[model samples]
Target chain A: MRAVDARVRALESILVEKGYVDPAALDEIIETYQHRVGPRNGAHVVARAWTDPAYAERLAADATAAVAELGYGGRGGEHLAAVFNSAREHHLVVCTLCSCYPWPVLGLPPVWYKSPAYRSRAVLEPRAVLAEFGTVLDDDVAVRVHDSTSELRYLVVPQRPAGTDDWPADALAAIVSRDSMIGTRLVSV
Target chain B: MFDEPWQASAFALAVALQDRGVLDRRDFAVALGGELESGHDYWDAWLAALEQLLAEHGLTNPGSLDERTAAWRRAAAATPHGSPVTLDADPQRLRHP
Candidate 1:
């Protein structure tokens, strides 16, 4: 376990002992995210979109409903939106106010997403942030930044890589990194 | 993503409290805002919000909180790295104290 995790646990134990927290309810929520939900849910959506043009259209039209069609919808992602990436355009997601992430799809927000530098820089210098993640987009591709909130969040539908047209949905999903879905990185072969 | 069980626990506990109406979400956000503005880390801000809410509800006082946090830190310091930092052998005493 991480050092920070230990400190957090110590604090939680104290809070529970003081009757400020309910241990069972806390455990239920933790176990749900830790074991049941994660990025795989997002990957499945991406893979389906990559394989089915109709589904992709539906996803673009209504992300929350489309995602729920695949049986993945819950708290932290009630209102969802999907932005498709193409040769001419790229999409990136950020939460400038706070760490408002699509938890059902992305699991928990990463440490960097919650950092002050990332929150501010993602809006001011998205290209630089993407570069640090090794995603070098061409000058021709226009980058669109989407700001997430407690009510609305975004998911990036990355362009399908070359040589994967015949690949199955599962194969495509295997290459979809969590960062790719977040638009900070690309899905590579 | 959370690195361990407690990190998620800490996060979930805050959410649960708000859902239970123990504290208002907006109020917690206001407290968290102060931490963020003060340049604290995200989880640190979360911890601060939790502490602030507990105090506001009269669940725990600042003195006891400080003492408990210091004790926890000392216990963690003495433990080997990567090992579980258990507090006092009798947790019940600490619980009631």
Candidate 2:
């Protein structure tokens, strides 16, 4: 059998020739995912929400639009919804069918996300899954699992840690993690 | 671990196709359904499924995809060690770019 790389490259070339895909655009996207975009973009959005109530409101109202407003343009930013992890509710995201993710914000989906166990268990037992990630929430806080499918991806806005009201947005962003935005890990300090 | 360059490229290609609305969720699902249950070579399965989808959409056929891949392999084998491998003068296309 031919190497998968060769096959993929061939398919890409064919697609490019047919005009279904543009080689330049595809290369740009590959370059972006390779070295440009990742979890940091998501952290910036989280930090902005934490620092500015107005921005947070905008994010809450329409996450995709809010993210674009922040000037993040790339793949997988088209459909997004910010699920705020407040005192009353906590959000966890998983792509049950496949590893759909917010590429513009959170970058690529982690390996475990594409696995069968994590995908099934995340929705079935979110609390247990969170505990496995070293995040054990109180019983009062509700667990809302978001099935982050291809069309509509989700971003978990973890609640602002206490006593950081005076911190700058950049400083706050430093503590916002990729898993925290995915709701697998909680942000502290 | 989609850490390799080709791995990222393959994954990105699918996402890019879907983003352009050329490939939908149902198309992705039908193509990738079988591999979703397996434990091996997820990316290979993904590429195969993409090829199938492209064929179904009349973009390109499986035979052409295979032939082009073989051509690339031959080109790489024939090229020098220090330079790039390009499908320059194949009989299928009159001019090489």
Candidate 3:
């Protein structure tokens, strides 16, 4: 990794020096993904949905437009779809073909999400995979795995946990984990 | 899609190059395909494609790329896992420090 880092940095420096690339722009882009843009965007969306039933209805009807309404859209998230997780059903998202994740909402896909084992098993034995993430569901709860393709991506809106009905959207957003949005885990109050 | 900082950098550099018209996407795709057929790791193929594109574009030479690769190898070897890796500007310090 160090070797690769050194080589990449060298290439970057050369490109920047030659006017082929802008170092500041590069830094800004990296900073955007590293800090500014990420799962927090999805949290806000989820929080809004929990607080506003009308917005939730709109999100369910057109995830792309609703998410864009919140100002989140870009590569890997051009076509966004939201799937609600209820007590009787659990939702999970995976990219069997490749790591076709929704970057605008979920940030970059994790290493496991890109691994062959995860891509295959996420659809094959979702229960077992969820169990590994410490999310064992009720036997009666149906596990619905959504596969993300290059054209469309899925975001799982976990059912609001019990005892948080009065909580504000900001407070609700605080407890929504990336895994919960991915459906590997559930949100808790 | 990337696991490490270097991977992200490599990816970004490629995109930057293509965006700047320094590297042609169609040519890059062909090179990438060839690299993939060569059976190297994914990023390795990416690096190979980038290097080849740079050569075709007269941006940098293989010798310089090799020198930088060696310098980075030393830096990586010296740095501990989970620690940030920094490359020294001076080649001598990069080799010995």
- Candidate 1, residue A11: lDDT: 62
Each model's C-alpha lDDT?
0.82, 0.81, 0.81
Q: Model 3, A1-189: lDDT tens per residue?
A: 545667787788677768988877677667767777789999999999999999999999999999999999865577899999998999999977656678899897777776667878999999999999999999999999998876679999999989998999999999999999999999987
C-alpha TM-score for every candidate = 0.80, 0.88, 0.73
Looking at model 1 chain A, report the run of 10 residues with the lowest lDDT sum. Answer: A1-10
Instruction: Give the worst 10-residue stretch by lDDT in candidate 3 chain A.
Output: A1-10
Docking band of candidate 1: acceptable
Q: Where does candidate 1 clash, by residue pair? A: A110-B1
Pairs in clash, predicted candidate 3: none
- Regions of model 3 farther than 4 Å from truth: A13-20, B1-5, B14-97
Candidates 1 and 3 compared: the better one by DockQ is: 1
TM-score of the A-chain for all models = 0.89, 0.93, 0.89
- Model 2 sits at an interface RMSD, in angstroms, of 2.6
Error of 3 at B40 (Å): 8.1
RMSD of each: 4.1, 2.9, 5.8
Q: Write the per-residue lDDT of candidate 1 for residues A32-107, one digit (tens) a residue.
A: 8778888999999999999999999999999999999999887777899999999999999987776778887888
Q: Determine the iRMS, in angstroms, of model 3.
A: 4.2
* Best of the candidates, TM-score: 2
Q: Give the range of the ten consecutive residues with the poorest summed lDDT in model 2 chain A.
A: A1-10
